[model samples]
Target: MARQCDLTGKARQANHKVSHANNKTRVFKQPNLKTKKVFDPESGQTIRLKLATSTIKTLDKLGLSKFLRKYYK
Candidate 1:
């Protein structure tokens, strides 16, 4: 499974690490993703999703159904 935020579409970002000598090394900045089980009150089902911490915070505020209704097409 990829490290991504399911709700926000956040993914890895590529960049270079620069050293004192100006040499660059390729690197990836991955989102803070965690596997969580979110329960949908309307459906009475628990969904497992990989989401960023920020998304989780938003979900905590708006709830699963409202968040899904607003975000999911």
Candidate 2:
């Protein structure tokens, strides 16, 4: 649709959505928890998530600083 001015020979066109390929759409599937984690999109790195939060806290408190140094960093 377009709007026209009554006093002058001028018109304004309405904005409309442009036609384009639906490249942003994605198909999702449920996770398979049995498999180990493989990727991290933010860092583009492969990682494993086998440790629980409780175990991590224990390690931090028990002075296993040398053992968990890699993961902590």
Q: What is the per-residue lDDT of model 1 for residues 21-72, given as tens digits with 9 covering 90 to 100?
A: 9999999999999999998777888999999999999999998878878988
Local distance difference test scores for all models: 0.91, 0.40
Q: Residue by residue across 4-33, what tens digits does model 2's lDDT show?
A: 322122343344444486345443332222
Sequence-dependent TM-score of model 1:
0.84
Error of 2 at 45 (Å): 19
Q: Which stretches of candidate 2 lie over 4 Å from their true place?
A: 1-49, 65-73
Q: Predict model 2's lDDT versus the native.
A: 0.40
